[model samples]
Each structure stands twice: as C-alpha cells, then as structure tokens.
Target: MFWVLLLLLAWAVAGAACTRLCLAAARAAAVGDTGAGIGSGRDLTLYEAAFLSGGPRRVADVTLVAMARQRRLLLAHTGWATVVDPRGRDEMERSVIGAIGPEGQSPIAPVRAAAATADAVRGIADRLVRAGLAVPDGAGTTIADAVRQVRLAVPVVAGLGAVALLMPAPAEMPRHLIAMWFALPLTLTLSCLAMARFEVHPYSRWASPAGQRLLGALPRHTDGAADDRTYLTCVAVRGIRAVGEPDLRAAFAHRERYLGQDDGR
Candidate 1:
C-alpha cells in the first residue's frame, strides 16, 4: 500500500542518518593521536596552549592581552585598540598590528577577528595538527554534521509515520502495527543520539585526546600574584575572562558589546 511505501521511506531516512553518524564517530575514534611529533618532549608554548585550549581565537586573545600588558598596545575600556609600538615582537603580534591597519587604531573586535584568521594563526593550527595535538580542519566537522543529520532525520521519520497512519490501512494490518514499525526507526535515532552523547560527544573540535592530556598536565594558574608566564598561560588556556586586571577584563567586555552592536548592523 501507499502507507507501506511511506514506512519504507522512513526506514531509509533513519537508517542512512544513523549509519552516517555512527561511521563518522567510528572514523574519528579510529584516528588516534600519539605523542610522537614535534611537541612530544617540550612543554607547550603559550601559543600552542592557547590553540589547544580554545583554538585560533584564543591565540589572538592571548597575544592581544600580552601586548597590552607590555605597553606595546593600548586596549582601552571602550573597545578601541591603539598600537603603541609599530614593530611587533613576533608574527602573532605583527598579525594583530597589521589587522589594525595603517591608521594604527581600530576596534578590538575586528582586530581580534582578523588576527584569528591571519596567516600566523593558520600556521599555529597547522603546526598543532602536524604535531598530533589538534583536530584536522574538517575532521571534527564530519562528526558534527553527521550528528545534525541524524537529529534532523528524527522529526522527518516521525512526520512520515504520522502521514502513513492517516492514510488507508489494509483490512488485517492494524494502525498500531504501522505505528510500531515507525517506532523502530524512532528508537534507532534516539538510541544513537544517547550513545553519541557518551561515546563521541567528548570529541573536541580543536584538541585531540593527546592534546587534552597535555592541557590537563599544565599547572593551574588561579592567583592574582602570578608571574607574567603564569598569568598569560592562564589567559591562553581559559581565555580573556581569566585576566586578573579589571581594566583588561573591562576592555574585552567593551569589545564584546561592540561586536554585538556591529553584528546587528
């Protein structure tokens, strides 16, 4: 019957989505990261730590905070960033300066955005990927996309089942029987989602398991009296919110508000 056709479609949709998600998760889980690359023996640099903890954006954040602290850049509480030194100490600093443009001043929000996508940041990501500490660019996205597809399929399957139930049924085949058939696909999708939550959901978009281990091994920096290394390490790992200075925190908050306003436009 036509309802049987709809039931078949439902099964196809649910099966394809769940299979794709499970395969993607399995593939991701298979590609293991071992400590055999450039970063094996050495402690993670601030940039590396930043990338592993929060990706390219965190690298830009830490660089901006470091330069601002050293008086090489001015991060005002009103969201503007002024370059005090034209010469950058490194490529990351140079990227931030370049992002600010020739006028030597720009909003911190745009500066952070441009710096995060700059070649310096890309290079950091490349190195981390090569070192087996970071997820490959689109590798993590595969799992995420598959999960989304499966989630979408759940409602689609339910809708198909509802439509089938509304249509004519055979003389002997009961309406509840058709519902039970639909319920099979629903159960499949739901069970897969639950399993994914435990098995594959810990998959980080930036750091691999090896990278996570390294991050966990780093000493925690929580005190206000920490040295520059400790303080910057904290900022790199935990982002701008970890900044102990009230002014620095205020500057970033202003940047966030400015971003919201800019996005509305």
Candidate 2:
C-alpha cells in the first residue's frame, strides 16, 4: 500500500508539475494573454495539445459547451449588422453587433483585426481560470482536483530525487552520486520546459483559426464565482504586485483590466 501510494503520488506530482510549467510557459509566450476560440467548430487546428493530453488535460473541450456552435450562430444572427465581420463578429460586443456591422460585410473588409479580437480572446483566458483548469495562484486549490493531484505529486517528486541520489545513475555525465545529483536537477528542468511548451501552440492556434472557431467558443459573459477564486489565488501568488488586494479595489481594478481581472484584485 505504501509503495502503491508513493507511485501514484509520483505520477500525480509529475502531472501537476507538468501542468503548471506548460501553462506558465504558454502565458509567457502569449505575453500574459490566453487567446480565444478553443473548441469552436470554426477552428480545429489548435487541437494539438487537446489531442496530446487527450481528455485528461484541463484546458481543452471539457469546459466548453458542446452546443457552443449554436451560441455563435445566435450572436451572428441577432447582430448581423456588426456581424458583417471579416473574422465574423468576434471582436465586437454581441449587444452592439448590429451597429458595428449591420451590412458592412463588404468583401474589402480586412480578414483579421487583432485589436478588435482582444476582448474576446482575453475573456477566454480569464474564464479558464474560473473553470478550475488553470492554477489558482499562491496556495489555494483553484482547480481543486488538479491542485490536489499536484500536491500529492510533490512528495513523490522529492522521493524520486532522494532515491535517484542513492542509486546508480547514467555514466554519460558521471557515475554514481555526482551523476545522480546533476541528472536530477537537469531532469526536473527539462520536465518543466516540456510542460510549458505544452501550454503555447494549441491555445494560440485557437485564437488564429480560419473559421475563427477558437475565438467563437468563448462564453459572452465571464464566470463571476470562478473569477473570484482566480483573482484571490493570483494575488496571493503574485504577492505585493497583485493587481487588487481587497474587495473594493479588486472589483474596479480587475474589471478595468481583463474580463474578471478583479476578484481579490
């Protein structure tokens, strides 16, 4: 039982660690932006990581509504005016869709407008944190299941490091203890890199797909409860530099920044 638990823990820690490194790297590569349009039928190419991690990966299809295509269709129909979007109405607010387009579907409209798409794209990133897919910052279990899994893995990771030190290690660098010491750190570092790499490509693909499918799947409204948890966790993790420290400041500050950038702010 002890050994069994240990192995499971090791696997969990490895999984959690991998999850963090990937998300962090993806966020960094994206310059703090988690682009939109994931799981939308319009763009399916960004499914790389979705495919790689399969269903177990938190950021993929699970949080998205299966009938999400209909939602976009509604946005398009109700606001066909502003919906005359080159990339569809992705950037425009759904409420104002008509005024923005009504009929400007002039074939000459530019195919993509990144700035216009900013609101929708950022909204998705903020929401993912809400759904418990991303880390919650500091120590709280933002994604309870994932966090618990990661916590379990921590000891396992430590155990592996300890065990590896006492065992015969590869001779490529050196033999015995010294090799194990160097090898452990290097392995950990590479694992971190591998995890981060996982966060980038697929999400970005969602933001830039042809049908704008990735951009389309985002819920028009942000998730408030999830947003609160995300804000508290991020501030706790970010410490003094946290955007908003308390309720009032957090409410206004976060709202002004990203969709739910507020919370504990």
Candidate 3:
C-alpha cells in the first residue's frame, strides 16, 4: 500500500507537468497572431523579406553579403570587413557601411552586432510586424516557451519511471501492475508532445503564417545582376553558411563565435 501511494505521487507529479505543458501550448496557439489575411498583397523589400523570414540579424547578414558580393565591401577570412566603394546603394547598405565607422574597416563581429541593432533594421522589423508578416516578440516568446515545456516531457516521464522501479516491493504486490501504472503518465506526456509538434511546429520562428506565404511567393532570379539578390534571399532563408565563398562564410562564422561567447556569459 505504501508503494502504491508512492507510485500515485509519482503519477500525480507527471500528470501535473503534462497538464502544465498542454495548457501552455494551448495558450500559445490561442493567442498566436493569425495575421491580417492570407494574401494582404503587400510586397516585401529585400530587408523586409529578410526580417519576415529570419528576423533582424538575417536582414543585416543579407545586407553584408550583398555588399560583399558587389565588391563594395570586402569580407576577409580573418574576420575583417573593409569598405571598397565607401558608397551604399540602399538604406541597409548605408547602415552597414556606417556601422564600420570612420575607419572604413572593422572586425566582422562588431560590425554584425552593430548592423543587427541599427535603426534601419528596427524599422524593417516594425514594418513587418505591423503588416502581419512577422511574428510579434511576445507571441514568438510564448511559442518558444511552449516548445521548451513540451521538451521536458521526456525527462519527466523518465524520472517517474525511475521512481516506480526503485520502490520496494512486498509479497503479493504485482510488479507488472506497477509498471503498467507508470505507463499512464508516460502516455500523457507523449500525447501532449505529439499534439504540440503537429499543431505548432509548422510555424517558422520569425514569420507568421501570412509571412510564410509571402516568403513562398517571392520571385527567384537567375540573371547576372540579380544573382546578388538571389544569394541574399538564400542567406535570408537558409542562413549565412549558404553563401558559397569560403572567405565570406568564414566572416559570418567568426561573428557567430563572438555571439556564442556572449550568450554563454
């Protein structure tokens, strides 16, 4: 009977954890910004598209990659970025050039950090959010939190199973019955996880549903002058590593290393 009480307690804890995850996921989904409409007919500029698909940092990355590809900026494997043209063709390019400062050159790490936080990037994000093409910060946080909660289900179930197995058994007590009882909580946790993956995993981290649809509708280009735009789009969608140039890839990798260090602290 004592062992039964212990098992019930374990089950109760698992049930409570599963309940919390389910409720969190429900709240996240319920409050998710469905956006203005499926087709608001709003066109996305390169920077706006980047923000919708990958957020502000991606907008900065696309701007840097585009400038580097155009020979306006030089990205070295040593993590230095030097201005070659000193002239920016657009607002985003101008922001990146400005972030490099009066020296006309700077480490890619600091340049990327500054570019991401630039006023132009903030403006792009704001526009995208207002147009319903980008996820609002609060909603994104909610979905992220729910995903994290669901991820805990596995460990919670494992801990409960361990507790059940460690309980002392007396004569006439069915060990198999205890194992079967443990299955109940495990089932609950697994069900909640499956439901979340099915329901919430379709949405991208940065873009809302309308934003995703717009991203899908963006035109592809293969012409010579359009190649830079194509590459920038690819970087905005698939990330910096999609850039084929070894030196350029290294430049972004160096930036990531510093960002990782900052996150660790």
Query: How do the predictions measure up, each by TM-score?
Result: 0.78, 0.23, 0.80
lDDT of 2 by residue, 1-265 (tens): 2333433445555766657644544443343233333323322222222221221111212111111222322212111212322333332234223323456331111111222234443454444434323222342222223334444555556666555455654455343444344445346545554443453334322122212233334322323454633433332222223333243223222222233231111
Question: Candidate 1: what lDDT?
Answer: 0.82
Q: lDDT of candidate 3?
A: 0.71
The models' CA-based lDDT, in order, is: 0.82, 0.33, 0.71
Residue 139 of model 3: what lDDT?
51
- Runs with alpha carbons beyond 4 Å of true place in candidate 2: 1-159, 163-189, 192-198, 201-264
**Across residues 173-265, which tens digit of lDDT does each residue of candidate 1 receive?**
999998998999999998988888887665455776567667877755678667899888888877777888888877887666545632210
Which regions of candidate 1 fall more than 4 Å away from where they truly are? Answer: 33-42, 138-140, 162-171, 218-228, 243-247, 253-265
Instruction: Show where candidate 3 strays beyond 4 Å.
Output: 1-34, 170-173, 218-226, 261-265
Candidate 1 lDDT trough over 10 residues, lowest sum: 256-265
Best by TM-score: 3
Report the alpha-carbon TM-score of model 1 versus the true structure: 0.78
Best by lDDT: 1
